[model samples]
Target: MARSKPATLKDVAALANVSRATAARALNSYGYVGDETAQKVQAAAGKLGYRGNRLAQALRSGQLPIVGCILGDIQNPFFARIAHDIEVLARECGYNLVIGSSEEELGQEVSLLASLRSLSIRGFIVAPTSADNNAHLQGLIAENVPLILIDRVAEGVDCDSVVVDNEGGAHKAVEYLIAMGHRRIGLLQDDMRIFTSRERMTGYRTALGAAGIAPDERMIAVSQSTVEHAVDATIRLFSQKTPPTALFTVDSLMTQGALLAFRSMGISIPHNVSLIGFDDFNLATFTDPQITVVSQPVSEIGRAAARLLFDRLSGKTDAPQKLRFETKLIVRGSVSRRG
Candidate 1:
């Protein structure tokens, strides 16, 4: 069905028998009008189905009032969820969003940023590629552009960032597994090139050290963004002569790959190999043996990132702020003490 065009200020003015300027002033909240008269104008505008032209207002103001959102690997549930929340919040604040995905490639990320710049986007919220491209990020910073990095932030990149407490979360996850009497634990981590992954690795080691368990480099597997990489790493860890009694994955995808590898190898959760992961997945509870996880406040992170960007756009730039949110250890059926 074809949609009807929205009624304009002129239509409302004709209905209300007031001047166009009076109708606009009432709609835009710009000027004082008699109480009863304002109500009459509002009722007439509502009856006429008038809607404000935001695009025209933006054009006149020379501000698109949009935030450029560039994410890495939109296929990942984590990224997709973040993008969804960002879009919802942007709309609520009377700002539109321009979204792009980099597919975890540095060149694609660079191109996406350039494309957004060409469109005159005043701000960006990005999940950059794990690989270091400090120069590209620094270039944006140098231009005094408002940028808020989420999930991952680069070293020496002086900008506001919203990140989970990766190290603390990992440490708590491993500590919980250790408390459950799992001494030989396997760590399935992402590419250590990223700062968050490195911090998680350190946390894993910290847990083992605090427990007086020797750090076994052999037990740690370096996985990438893909499920194949995670699966391969898990296979290597489980194939050891004395396999780990429990598994801990750094992220949701790695957790899924770990579960798949266990299924393929006919290993029973908890009975054969207890499992826990860092990031929460949508179907974590639906699995036969529900996976335990360190749950991050993803929506809150997105909201924080947007709020930071909005503040900067509102001219609140003073010093770069790095915000980290706490995580929760969600206990499910995935982990148990070794028999």
Candidate 2:
């Protein structure tokens, strides 16, 4: 059996009684066209099942129809949601999205960026893995690539960014614990080298200072880069003869590890000690003592990043902007009233 050829722009123009130039403008949204004529062209293309060659279109205008998204850990459900939102917005803006994960490794991040650049990705939305290894990103900026940072910011890289107020959220959550008389609250977080972790740690310290509670060195634990490692860290904290009455875990992975450790130690939530998590997810509400969490606006972050990238692509030659979204504390059954 012979396969039929794909539809072409000429076929659409002939069916719509319009010139190829008008059809191209109407379809690409580059130039103004009469509403009725544009509708006719669109309908004709749809009826003929026309799919334009993106490379051809780019050659015509020196513009690519693709953007790339890179993230530190795509396994995080929140990051997954962000990726989905970015993809939807890209499609709506007539650009395709390609995603890659760096796995929080500098080498992987560098390799992914190089590969995406070779693909002619016109813009990038990235959650950088390391603060120090930013020379590669600086190269991208020097080359005049449209870039937007998400979730985390790099050192000395001036670009548009979308991040939640980690400091405020952690401060509020810890202050609430302090108000409930949890003077011996412990903090468990990812490696302090990460920007978000640093901001969150500062917030936790600020809350303790505001309440006149001297922060304990032993209770302040960092250096865990994985969920399983966090389990051991939590155990070490609980093993202290005078342990904290409450625990605040930063990030979803560490929170999961801490919860698992509590279960293994036969500890009761809000009875033996209290718990609060950062970055809310479905499991937070479903836990036995529904977790109190600092919730980031995931969809808004994705949308804002998309808008920033588009602005850059549209020849907005202005100073880069940093957008910080606020986080909310969702009080649940995790904390107990200190009598």
Candidate 3:
């Protein structure tokens, strides 16, 4: 069925027996209008379901001095930190930061970009869903939009990016487990869509290779994209004939899921299953035996990304900048030395 056209200001005005300008003034409370006329216009608008377009109004006034921070997951504290930093920094430079979470979806990403572009968003910091953009990102580049990618970088798109050293962090964590005499170390990771996940997996493989430890296929748990999936993966890993003595998770949320699964299954940490999770969070130390994790500088990544965005907006750097922050291993009673 063909959808009916949206009601406009003119439609509301006609129903109220008033000029469009009078209807606009009454609806927006911009200028004086008689109480009776305002009520009539309001009633007409309500009946027709008319709503003024704020984006269009902003676009008409002038180029909006706003920066948009688009993220993959809103629930992740990592993204929340980045958004906070970007908003703080952008506001300092006389710009408002608008945030939109794409929920790690390609269609949502494209729609948000299109909508924000229409509003003349001055800059964009996006943790893209996938590297393949179908030319949507390339179009943004061609349009000369100031863009900075945070946490993830696209395949063919050449733009500014601020990311943590995923491989280095993973290697550091896994190597420490090996030093503690854990030979059967398991790698629990998400789907290799995002570059960060892939990099962490690479680091896992690199660490095992360098240590002369043979990679065991059964010990690896993958296809974990959500917390529930990660919980299931942990259960599957432990259900195996010969489970790994120590486990390394790729990200914070998944690590939490693993911890929960362990608790539910009555698997004691550092006793029955030594563990190392990625991205240290508030709950790390609150755990029974505290979690040892590979900690990335969340604040650093956000500030660096905002700086890159400001630089681009200010025409300071025409060339793209890829800044990789260092990650550290924080030992906090999570992994035990194998006897």
Candidate 4:
């Protein structure tokens, strides 16, 4: 069987008894055309089932009805929520959303951005993998592309961003643990190249310094932002002869990993080792002792970033908006008072 060819604009023009230029103007409603001529073009198009090529039209106009999103890790619930919110807003604005995950790799991020740029996507929302090393992002700014940094920001990429107060949140969590008389504290964090990880580490160090506790390199563990890796890192941290009385995890997945590690090692939460994490997860309260965490405005971050991109798409040429939302410490049974 032979595949029938789809109808084209030239066919519609010939059937309408008009030039291709005139037919284009009539079908697109751009230039002035007589009512009878437009009706004729419409009739001809309907008869031939001439569905115009959207990609070809977009290339001619230099804009596509699509928004690209690159997140750190789609498997993480935090990123998943943000992606969902952005997709919802994109749909409401009559734009399709294309999503990719960097997986915390700078090379992958650069490659993904280049691929999306080749498609002439209208705008982008990205959670950069590295705080520095972002020449690819700078290229977008140079090209006047609509880009919004979400969750994380890159160095010298002066674009609109939506991030939470990571330093403040970490400081609050550590300070609370200190108030409970936990002098030896541990940190399970992502790679230091990540903006949020660096900020949270700073907060941890500053809080310890303020409490007259010397910073100990043995107390810190770096791991990729995944449950499996965090489990290994947690086990290593706790296996030391003298471990921290309390621990702080940078994200929810790591927090869950710590819980699993403790369970496997015959250690108990709040009784054996107090705990606090940066982001809240769905199962935070489902455990025996509810997990304490610093909760950010995950629901608002994505929607705000999407709105900023849409504004730029609509020709709003204002100053780049840097939105930083506050984080709240949700105290639960995970942390216990220690001497």
Candidate 5:
């Protein structure tokens, strides 16, 4: 079989019956092309399956034309969606995304970051593994790398960050349950070592304090990012002497665990135990009672983080920014009053 030639700018121009400069003007939005002409050029480009050579362009401009995105875990729906949005926005901005996932392992994250540096990717959007990895992050900053932390922020590591307000989101979720008259609420937290987990736990505690409900250590369970661990934790929480009336899970895995435990134990949702979770998932709406959750702007956060990194690479040297987006509690069938 004969190999196909990659479509070029010339192919698009030739198919559009216009000069190369005119086609470039239309495609690059450089100005002076009529609407009809622009449409024709775009149609021809589409027909020819034309794509600009971003690498070559970047070489000419002395930049990589690629953004490095380091995700905490690709298995999580939250991170997967963020990666998809980052790629979409990077393409829209005339750039490409090089994605990597750490799976919550420290050494692997450092290795991937170092490789990206060796590949000359000076711009990054990362959801770091732990706050303990400050030195590794500081090295990137010292190298003048434009870094934006997403979802999880490293402690003592100064850089641009885009995150949903974890504490505030947790507080709202808990408060929603409280208003429904559930005094005994359980918390299923991610590994306590993770920054978001710690912040969320703090939020949960703060909400209990405000509600005049004493915090119960026995009602809280912490686990790694595994369904098995989460399920075990949920079981422990529910098996306590004074079982909680409702459960608040911090992440998608924990939510699944809590739900699975409910199913296995023959406990009906919102009747035996109400549930609320962070980071909405597709299955959240389709379950027996649609899960009530605090919805975060995952795609928006991803795009904003990428934009921040791009701005830094473009020589915008204002102080590092910390962007905190709000989360909203989506009341659904899963949460109800304790009768």
Candidate 6:
């Protein structure tokens, strides 16, 4: 069987007995066209089923009615919620959202941004994978693209951003652990190249130092922010003869991993070891002992970032707004007094 070719604007113009320019004007409704000519163009387009190339039109207009979001890992519930909220707001603003997960890879982040940029996307909201190495982000800034940094910020990329007080949140959790007399504390964290990870690590060390407990490298475990990787890292950290009495995981996925690792090792929460984590998850409260966590305003971060980007898109010329929300320690049954 022979395949039929799709109809084009030229075919519609020829069928309507009008010039291509006049047909385009009538179809697109941009310029003056007689009422009869407009109706003829519409009827011809309907007959031929001709659809304008939206991508080409967007290129000619110098911007697309779409927003791109690059998140670290969409599997993480925190990032998932943010993506959802951003999508809602983008839709309300008459723009579509396109999300891509970098999976904590800087190269992947760069590539995703480049791909979206090629489409002339109107703006971007990114959770940068690396704190420092972000020349690609800098390129966006230099080009005056509406870019909003979410969850994490890249160094030297002066643009709107929405982040939590990671250091303060970690400090509060670790300080509470120290106050409970847990001197041997463990820190399960992500790659230090990540902005949030570095800040949380600093808080962990600060709390330890404040309590006069020497920082022990043996007590720390570095893992990718995933349940499986964190499980292995937690096992390695606790395999030592002198394991930490309590653990602080940087994010909820790692918290879940630590719980699994403890269960496999026959370690009971708040009995054999106490635990606290950054970012709250659905399973945090459903466990045998509800997990304590440093809870950020996850629901607000995405909306705020989207608002900033839309504001820029709407021609707001204010200085780059750096919005930092605070985190609160939601204490549960996860931690117990050491002494």
Give the candidate number with the greatest TM-score: 4
In candidate 5, what are the lDDT values of residues 1-339, reduced to their tens digit?
442877888989999999999999999998799999999999999887788876666666656878888887778888888898888878987778898888788888899988988777758888888877667788888878888999888988889999889999999999888999999989999877688998889889898999999998888888887788999888888887789999999988889988999999888998899999998888899997999999898879877887787788779999989999999899889988876
lDDT of each: 0.86, 0.89, 0.87, 0.94, 0.87, 0.94
lDDT of 6 by residue, 1-339 (tens): 432867788999999999999999998899799999999999999988898767777978999999999998787789899999999999999899999999888899999999999999999999999999999999999999999998898899999999999999999999999999899999999999999999999999998899999999999999998899999999999999999999999998899899999999999998999999999989999998899999999999999999999999999989999999999999999999978
Per-candidate TM-scores read 0.82, 0.85, 0.81, 0.95, 0.81, 0.91
Better of 2 and 4 by TM-score: 4
- lDDT, candidate 5, residue 47? 83
lDDT of 3 by residue, 1-339 (tens): 443877888999999999999999998898899999999999999988888755566668656789888898777988998888888898899788888888777899989989989888888998888866637787888888888888988888889988889999999999999999999998888777778888998899899999999888888888545788889999999888888999999988889889988998999998999999999989999988999999999989889999898888778756788888999999999999997
Off-target runs (Cα >4 Å) in candidate 5 are 1-63
Residue 293 miss distance in model 6 (angstroms): 0.9
Off by over 4 Å in 3: 1-62, 223-225
**Least well predicted 10-residue stretch by lDDT in candidate 3:** 53-62
Candidate 2 lDDT over 222-335, as tens digits, reads: 746567888999999999999889999998888888899899999889899899999998898788889989999987999899989988888998999999999999999989
Model 4 misses residue 297 by how many Å?
0.8
* lDDT score, candidate 1, position 46: 84
- The better-scoring model by TM-score among 1 and 6 is 6
Error of 1 at 313 (Å): 1.5
Per-structure clash totals for the candidates: 0, 0, 0, 0, 0, 0
Please write out the lDDT profile of model 4 over residues 1-339, one tens digit for every residue: 442988889999999999999899999899899999999999999999899977888999988899999998788999999999999999999899999988888999999999999999989999999999999999999999999998888899999999999999999999999999999899999999999999999999889988999999999999988899999999999999999999999999999999999999999999999999999999899998999999999999999999999999999999999999999999989999986
Q: Model 6, poorest ten-residue lDDT window?
A: 1-10
What stretches of model 6 exceed 4 Å from their correct place?
Answer: 1-7, 43-50
